[model samples]
Target: MIFFDTIGTMAIGSRLRMLSERITEDARQVYELYGVGLKPKWFPVFYVLSQNNEKSITEIAKEIGHSHPSVSKIVREMSKDGIISEEKDKNDGRKNNIKLTSKGKSLALKMENQCFDVKSAVDDILVQTKHNMWNAIGEFEFLLDDKSLLKRVIEQKKKRESYNVEIIPYEEKYKQTFRQLNEEWINHYFKMEEADRKALEHPKEYILDKGGHILIALYKNKAVGVCALIKMNESEYDFELAKMAVSSEAKGKGIGWVLGKAIIEKSRSLNAKKIYLESNTVLTPAINLYQKLGFKKIVGHPTPYERCNIQMELNLG
Candidate 1:
């Protein structure tokens, strides 16, 4: 039924592992037929030492891009079989140097012919296929190396969830909700300072009345995130992004991203050339979000909040 085809990309790892095992089984059979006692798993290390007969386990691991412990285990197994020898380093007692044994050297000579045969067979298969599997695999590895599978999936998840998030302008009805959301996060991280109370407790008086704006993120019709852009002197930063908070329940649903983006657009609409913010390093995720939005870290800024340890500015100019 080709279950993996039905299950789709979610089973990609399983599919690839299955393909690897199939190829390994074929190579194992071929090795036995050719009277070569080498295991397919040992090919990488064996081929490496064939090129450079003497290398430390660390060096081999680096050359092959395998973990040190994994290489160590393989070395131990090959040593047990008398296919490789390990000697204590005279310069560094803690390190062991690896080299192929007499038997392993002879096997390497035989494998050279087998490698040519394998290459010819692989070329035959490639001609029969629509695309070159090696090239596709190389491209896939390059992309995964750039970002990682986990990070790519998280980005997709956020993109999917962002559709359900709605960013709306602030109204008097959302005033208390905004304050509650900010206070929820503040109280959890650090005690609220006087500036926080003045801003959150009376957003209209301290922020809005002075040419500021607020944004609310509605997750499925429920308000769960808020951020404010307080007007600053036009000569300096035109606006300050502050008081951003998202409800714990909606934390992983990309509500924060939507609110931040909306706030930045709001500032741009007000003809702001630059935006500023104050935050603590302890708020790592928040700091990362600001950095992602093109904010650069700055110094020599005074703050009214004791919890503030870092300052950032985004130059829209």
Candidate 2:
């Protein structure tokens, strides 16, 4: 069996590179067949200059989504071949405006016609195949634009490492662990206020007895995170998500996200319509996690803690 076949989807980058090389080879042949005076790689820069008449290397890079250095390298090669010429920018003396030569403009007209035939051939191949590769590539690029491949892979890595983490209901044995986690984060940033002391010191009396719920995340039988859902009496929100904290050791293991999700599910199970939260902008990661859980910033809410500068709510209904 082939090495790529053995690796399956792991060879996606290699497979796409191979496919691109094949298409580029065909482009070279097509250019020769039409007797067009343009290199296969020069078509992009040539086409851009044909339409815009003038552009700087930075503009070309932004338009084609290539790196500045790569575009500069291509521009240098095209200039050496007499396909493009550079003139100093009228407004910016330091920048050079790139435009096509007379010979390049003539080649552009021929390549434009060549493109129509190549497009038709691609369409024919699309019809012959079960799936449309063009549309598939567009959709895949759209997804990558929304969330990069690096971020997606990091999330998967977090999930794999957090598979052993278990979320469990509050118990007497975990009371101290809960306080320790919350206090570690609180004292690291702001002073522990009276409201925080009341809730953390007497969670059973201040939170649990008031119909609130606490959850603890256990990693390898060691408690690493905690969150509380305090049942609210307000008309708009049914619960207030509070007292959420994760151990510094388990920071990137997705413990906060998992604890947050479990708390949200608990609120939903309790027939909550909206869940509210109060936070400070200094806690950027926490705020980001809330947003990822569909929470939106809200205003005009009073808070007992001095550190509460921002409020958000998630509408489950």
Candidate 3:
């Protein structure tokens, strides 16, 4: 006989039931607002298009983590409802391109605003809960995994963690090495004029002042990379992510991403609202790493020097 009164069975059943009911009710409400014909899952596809307009079906599916067939089905239904349009890909004759129709675009905008309002309301509640919900869910997942399998995975991680990469707070002793790395990086990637190189080599003042911090990544006691965070203003809590350069000898060891994560975590600890970075397109690897870390492209304000560069920002608040 099945034991319904067991703690594990009852807990799992209760949670699953609650989640199913919540999802069903949300889908029903969204369908009623948009139209009885629209599937709630398609809303994410619409939202992605609304942000980055005109993506192929494959791109849409990948971004939304849905299978191509599923996305195709949703697109076909939306096309029939006059909510979206499909076209043949010019470059790839076999692929079908997708974009939002006038009605779909309008609905997407409304949905986006609704999502923002919902997020704001949820944030207020989450502030009090302090992310307890997420912690509970994580604990449940951990419990579900086999103990032996989990121990093996954790042991593998510990073995890899033996590679020691020390990040030291910047000090007078390491200033020369930091400048050397920056100079080498500029010459390698940036076609810096003599004056520009000088400016970087000898800034009027160190990038980080009061309420600012710098870190130098040391690999086996050698200074391999340097990064800085400077407090721009109190209200905005802006910090400049500057002097991020790795030694040529130390390229491609995944050091850059490590330094980036460290800087971001430190900024969060300092209660920063946002972090801004200036970089050039020539540094494709760096730009890719930044995007992977959730930094978005934005317009740059006037700076001390003239370098054709791209500016990126991350909202911490």
Error of 2 at 154 (Å): 3.8
Give TM-scores for every candidate, taking all chains together and pairing residue i with residue i.
0.93, 0.81, 0.46
Residues forming the 10-long window of minimal summed lDDT in candidate 3: 1-10
- What are the candidates' C-alpha RMSDs? 1.8, 3.4, 15.7
Give the per-residue lDDT digits (tens) of candidate 3, residues 1-317.
23444556536657677777887677668567644445666777777888876999889989987898998988888889888898888898898788889888777766665667556865776678956665776787686564654566655553454265688788777778877888787777665665445435544354554567878898778888888786676434378787788888877566777788899999898878799877888889889989988899987465554564788889998
| TM-score, model 1 to reference | 0.93
What do the candidate models score in CA lDDT, each in turn?
0.91, 0.91, 0.75
Candidate 3 deviation (Cα RMSD): 15.7
Error of 3 at 242 (Å): 0.7
Question: Mind giving the per-residue lDDT tens digits that candidate 2 earns over 1-317?
Answer: 38788999867888999989999998889988999967788777777889997999999999988899989999999999898999999999999999999878878877777889988999999999998998999999999999998899999988997898899999988889889988999999999999999999999998999999999999888899999998788558888999999999988999899999999999999999999999999999999999999999999988899999999999999
lDDT of 1: 0.91
lDDT of 3 at 227: 83
Q: Which structure is stronger by TM-score: 2 or 3?
A: 2
Model 1 residue runs over 4 Å out of place are 233-235
RMSD to native, candidate 1: 1.8
TM-score of 3: 0.46
Question: For model 3, what is the C-alpha lDDT against the true structure?
Answer: 0.75
